[model samples]
Target: MSRDQLVTLAQALRELGGAVPEPVPSGAREDSSFSGGRARKISVSMPEDLSAAVQQRVGRGEFSKYVTEAVAQRLESDLLAELVGLLDEEHGEVPEDLVAEAEGAWPDVE
Candidate 1:
């Protein structure tokens, strides 16, 4: 995504009471090897209260990592939704009975 779009998303998350990390410097490179990809640094705007809350929970050093994970999850969810839409368009919606059966078969985790 473009930097401006990321900034806008961060701001929206902040407005919704979500924590967003301060931007990493242009010179810094995030080691995203753990996730099998390279990471890019970009600027983001977030509220001080949310920032403080995140720091309290994960500490200042992990702020960026925390936000990265949250954004990743959101993106994955968006992709899944898009996939579902495509599937529904190609082959009508899944039967409610099948959905109910799938839900019942899904493992419940504590």
Candidate 2:
């Protein structure tokens, strides 16, 4: 990986309070014991402000490791959120009367 990409990855890991990773063996393929599923792509928008932040870490000759780490983190975060919503009592749907009572009396979604 490029030097710029390596720095980028380190920042991403640090931001997430994770350890930086070691390089894979020279001939080993990227392991995916936890890969989500068959891959597909979709686009999402990011605020312009984030670009400068990303670029600052991925500047010329900088490590670009942050790209992979960031993507993995984002995917993991989204998956965990989905799982939590499904499994957590507070996050998913509620009975109609309970919802109304909470909404009217407590003014809170939960």
Alpha carbon lDDT of each predicted model: 0.61, 0.48
Q: Can you give the lDDT of residue 83 in candidate 2? A: 45
lDDT of candidate 1 over 1-110, digit per residue (tens):
43335455556555544555643333222432124335666898899999889989997688778887677567645544555565576679999999888888885932
Error of 1 at 36 (Å): 3.7
Candidate 2 segments whose C-alpha is farther than 4 A from its true place: 1-49, 61-64, 89-110
Q: Cα-based RMSD of the predictions, in order? A: 10.4, 14.4
Name the runs in model 1 displaced over 4 angstroms.
1-34, 107-110
Error of 1 at 62 (Å): 0.6
Error of 1 at 72 (Å): 0.6
lDDT of 2 at 99: 63
- Tens digits of lDDT, candidate 2, 1-110: 33334445555554555454542223211333222233333454677778567768688533234444566556556444544454444445666998687789976545
**What is residue 23's positional error in candidate 1, in angstroms?**
20
